[model samples]
Target chain A: MKLLLLSNSAAPGRSYLDHAREVIAEHLDGVTELLFVPYALADHDGYTAKVAAFMDTLGIRVRGAHTAREPRELVASAQAVFIGGGNSFRLLKSLQRHGLVDAVARRIRADGVPYMGSSAGTNMACPTLRTTNDMPIVQPVSFDTLGLVPFQINPHYLDPVPGSAHMGETREERLRQLLEENDVPVLGLREGTWLRRSHDALELGGLAAGARLFTSGAEPVEHAPGADLSPLLAAEARFDCRPD
Target chain B: MKLLLLSNSAAPGRSYLDHAREVIAEHLDGVTELLFVPYALADHDGYTAKVAAFMDTLGIRVRGAHTAREPRELVASAQAVFIGGGNSFRLLKSLQRHGLVDAVARRIRADGVPYMGSSAGTNMACPTLRTTNDMPIVQPVSFDTLGLVPFQINPHYLDPVPGSAHMGETREERLRQLLEENDVPVLGLREGTWLRRSHDALELGGLAAGARLFTSGAEPVEHAPGADLSPLLAAEARFDCRPD
Candidate 1:
């Protein structure tokens, strides 16, 4: 199974076009069951509609794409689940009430369904949804989600805050505290960059910008992010994001 | 299954203690399996010790507790799990790499084990961790987590940001976006406050500092948030917390 995680909704990296293309490729080009979760998609109304248009453009078959109506049924026939980005919290909670979580999990475990997510969708792959750095107004029961991917992903990685005296714990400090207490690798994906997991490892994808990989076992590494993705043409094959 | 989620490590909620006591007295007490996951126990070396002491004082036997060590076996054995808070990201990744992901799922599913998470721990109980206002420096591979609770938990609830050009997203905005995206409720769990889910409904806990509950299907309602936790107490259950 292959899963794609994007940090945001706007254009892959900069504003949204590339992200759109990535979704098409992940869902239409080489998969069977397609599931798109747009928690953050709410911020931009055009998100789901635009994706609907894109599905038509690519001629990809979508068994389930929304959480508002007939929610759990959508995941029943899906071979690929695509979760678009917007707000991670809202997206997840929507998935919960509609009772589609089990459907997604079953698809992943029993069917080896191909999974694709961007922004908020990508965030859902981690152990907890707290790493998304999105606002916290909405509350779902848990930050836990589909464990298709292994690393906690930061889609839009920005530089450290400028100046001193902000006093509040800086984002880096918070993450550092996380690292100090835990034993997993942290990946900082810049705009236009993505992470792909299949088989047995995690690999960086997307060429729009550079990506940084951080792990408890070693120092941080930076890379250009992705390949042509032509290597993943086969639909049934599995991909792992870990380094070889 | 009886679960207890705490806010911060600083103090155990009076209401939380009360409810736990009551649950133990009615059906758990001696038969309960007590497991403490200090997955976020970093920064202060005293954190873990403090937790240990608290358990000792409560007269609860620490069947097992984990600091840096993976607790797969312990998680598997426990009838209930209490995850403490430190950093949301840290706690999350620990849960992920330790293979606690599947273990937690099993406990919740087959065993119907009670799951309690606080602060960082509380953040992990949601569907997605995006509800937290914590900074994103440390990144975990995926946003997957234990789905014991079904609401976005915003620990340390506070008033609006007075005024600032912080550049980075504000805490309120983070919470707002989380709520806007999905249909689940957001629990604005101020320090000393908590939400409890029993059978099929949710109960607000903590009087010293009351918590607020937000749902996409309904407007946000404040659970009692105050200093006096006596009203929220359950009775006769032993518990513990430590600062490492």
Candidate 2:
């Protein structure tokens, strides 16, 4: 029942995992090795190597699910778990293809393995991948995800740019349309921000802007950094339905 | 196969359907009554009323698919068809829900009923709705669309904004990822531009900019305004496969 959902791996001009170093360290406390899910990015080997190198700096050993004979068994016995960002649809498809969706979720919930993900990885922890901003390049068997967290996570969220000529739907409008069809709450995790879930308590963290919360029948509200976000977790209990 | 696929309904400070009035008039030549699919927008009646009022000026009568007792029958017999802009996933779901997908495609390809769509509507004309920029707020039974056109259409295409802080996938990157898993061509239609298809001929039109074509094993190529896009249609023939 522990999670560290990051909006992105790093802020602008920062190295990989630079902004999230301390948070990752704290989440992986006393852990020397972890299972890394690199299915989001297409180049499994390159992605695995890049992430493994980064984790090495944190003094943690990294093993990729791609190299495992039984990815589920690796997740079950891992000291910690992390999923990197790329295409959410691709990641979900791989998870379903490898039959690891339930395994990853069980490891995080029942086994209490510390789960960490960024971008598409963060989206994997949600009730459904419906709130993802990634293009539907591939269709997963279902939009369902791990449900490690009760609410949805929109990673790398951004407000509309001012005076811009682009006419595509803004991030907020997209989430609003999702709310019309789905009753679950959505956390708009701006870059450098993340949600920390521990048992019954959830909190927002990081610098820069606060997280934007989109709940049904309400205007989106902002939660300051380091603020307790357990209310959204509780609100998830009130709504018993998940998007089909 | 007659089609008018627009990148957007209107540009900044322009009336609804204003920029494409002449093209729409030319495409709908000799047609008095046309079928309007307004399921993309949430307010069906409001969307129908607004579009009806606008068509009144062009001396054309509009019938909404929403009010029809048999939506598929209406699509089959319509003199022409038009779908407005909104969430692509929602529109695709409604099309599948009311069983209008095949009917609309048959009307356009077999019956030669002129098909006109903006934004989500344009995406529907493609083989698959994968290239759509709209959020996947709703998961359609499938991403398959009408297949009226051989390639995918990315409406409202824009390059990365200069000095912008947004880290979401760029239009080109999203399309590139699509090409990774798909071999079909993708046309990035900038705002104010559209594709005009008549039988076997295809062309680009409008004021803003050229259309960017993303094909397999090639960097994106720009087609100047008013250029004949018939080559792409022929290439579609050589491939002999449609996106699933």
Best by TM-score: 2
Candidate 2 lDDT over residue span B1-244, tens digit each: 8999999996788788988889888999899998999988778899998889889889999999999877987886789999999988989998998999988888888878899999999999888878888778777898899888777888988876788666667778888877777678889998999999988889999974778999888988888889998877765522212221
Model 2: per-residue Cα lDDT over A1-244, one tens digit each? 9999999985788888888899899999999998999988778889888888888998998999989777887887899999999989888988998899998888888889899999999999987888888888877888889988778889888887888666667899898878777788888999989889999999999975979988888989988898988877765522213332
TM-score of 1: 0.50
DockQ of each: 0.17, 0.51
Candidate 2 TM-score versus the reference: 0.95
C-alpha lDDT of residue B190 in model 1: 67
iRMS for model 2? 3.6
CAPRI quality band, candidate 2: medium
Error of 2 at B229 (Å): 1.4
What is the C-alpha lDDT profile of model 1 across A49-119, one tens digit per residue? 66665665566644435543676666776767777766565667667767766678678767777777766
Restricted to chain B, the TM-score per model reads 0.73, 0.94
Interface RMSD of 1: 9.8
Count clashing residue pairs in model 2. Answer: 0
